[model samples]
Target: MARRNHTTELGSIACDDLTELGAGKEGWLVDNPNLLTALDTHSLAIANHSVVLVLDWSDGSDPTGPRVKIRPTLSPIESEYISSVEWLVFDDIRVLALGTSCGYLLIYSLRGDLIHKQIVNPGRILKLRVRGTKRDLTEDTSSAEICVVMPGVVARFDGSEIQSMLQRWFQETHSQFWDQKKNPVDSGSSNVRLPYQLWNVNKYGSCADAAITGIMPPPLMELQSSQRYYCAVTIGDDAVISAFRLAWWDFTLC
Candidate 1:
């Protein structure tokens, strides 16, 4: 079993994952929604809208800014829950991509002070996979592209190109978690390692099949501004905490 430990924050954090809930029992933001507890200076946004949900848990007090309510983007058409979110940079403007639990990607613009929402079509694909990893740390499209991984398949959006890189990369880079286990019953032959299982995305576009992994699991939705990125995530039933760096995107494409 894995567990998460909470850290102190600047003041208050905003609701990103849970709309009206906190993380865990021993956690500060435990089961807290709409309000952040013990978080550092961080911000949250979905797609492209004007106002950024900024948080600064540094003061260890209450928020001083004007109260803002995060209302769900309601519509007559039903939509699935959001699975992952990524922040992109385009020259002078900022872009947002909210990966839905149903495999749809919503694009937004965060230039100046407003957010503009738009839907993107992946064309022929019936389902899409959206997830983020802290390992990719570039200021380019590597971090921004929603890398779709399937059985022996990996594709990414590179400008007008849907490139296949993960298939080759996984064959060359990723592998089974433990290959050194010579004996299972022999406790002395092997040591207990962190749960780093490689899980695929849900079929209906939800993040259902996404299992826990690694000693310190990263957050699903990551917010980035300028050169910094902040993440709030957990591992197993007990949530862990950490911040990660992400790759920048190419805003050269209009």
Candidate 2:
């Protein structure tokens, strides 16, 4: 198993301590790092601090082929800090979803373009995952969703709907900025509201005092028509596990 130290102390180390430990120099450390393979498996993303590294491994299992660096596009006065990241792929499109310590979720295309950004939580996001299956003509189904997991809350959003909203937002913002007759200040900013269904495991009668830390959707087989229903599971820091069932209709939770 791969292991890494996640602990850090603010105090300085003595020279004698370094000499006793092979005289090594001090180095920076990462807290709560995350790594995951994209759905395609040909790509991998690693997040540390305020940057994410997207690596392609198509050329014969080589670890060093090409790397793309992705960073949050913040205003000059804003700070950039990433806490987690996940891959979101739909049909022929692939994008990276980054979660920040300040409750911001930023989505970026493979070419490092900022596609969409929003604040999904009031606290740090602990985990993220893209749920739901692609549109299937033979099965006559369409269900694409994104799941955002944070302390004490699990928010679900429709993936296709979000994509549509972002496209419209980009066009309107661009036109409003260039129209000199209209006051740029009056153009008004777009705030993507939480078009999400939230699940609070804490309110579900769990005795655990800790907040929710992770969540996952039912497996694909369980989501099929044969199952007749869909479910999700959430984990809490205090070792409490909660499961929820929702009626499925036309690829949505009813």
Candidate 3:
């Protein structure tokens, strides 16, 4: 982990403390009253963080601009390769969920201790979301509930059989991602637009070219007209912000 320290005397720092990093060190530190509660492949949903947060690159504007800092009092997650974090809608509150490269889906409390750790193997979860498919005009609309999209497949969790299905989907999916030529087939010329249309785990099958290629689908789809999704904001291993339209899944209404 990287380390740096700043000294404060009376809620303010001496100007001499500003060395190479910048004068706006204080500006980079914002407080979150609440943090995210859930994690999936695409993004983490946070609570008590802010009503509306802007994720633009700061160019390291220290004490003069807005930036955020993790709760100094809290310990970081034990795992190092956390790919993504998100908030899931639970009852009336948001919960933080973390996705790890070691195929772990960890649920944590606001204080950041692991509360639930489920092994979602094979594929590393890059995104997660709930689908409330709207009914077609020919079908009844009142009987619908939400379904979960893990990595390669989507399924309705009944508190029993869903986890098993999700595990199978995630593993096969990861295997497929790692084994590139087996899935993509034709490389750049291939027309296999992803996110596994209809959850077919092995459309191509396992092969020799398996690696962590960064090519994947868009993060979140259900836009809600007013929400924002954050992507990488920098070049070559940096964070960026991107936005998209959230389309309501239409075929699953039955």
TM-score of each: 0.33, 0.57, 0.31
Clashing pairs in 2: none
Output the worst ten-in-a-row residue range by lDDT, candidate 3. 228-237
Better of 2 and 3 by lDDT: 2
**What would the TM-score be for candidate 2 when compared with the true structure?**
0.57
**Candidate 2 on 1-254: residue-level lDDT in tens?**
88988995432223232232233434321222233224345676655665566666554644533456665654445554676678876655677887876777777767565666677767777667766664664887766777767776666777877667656645664575445433322332335553665555445553222222223354666544443334556665667777655433323231
Query: Which has the higher TM-score value, candidate number 2 or candidate number 3?
Result: 2
Ranking by lDDT: 2, 3, 1
- Candidates in order have lDDT scores of 0.31, 0.57, 0.32
- What's the lDDT for candidate 3? 0.32
lDDT at residue 217 of model 1 (Cα atoms): 28
In order of TM-score, best first, we have 2, 1, 3
Which portions of model 3 show Cα errors greater than 4 Å? 1-80, 133-200, 204-254
Candidate maximizing TM-score? 2
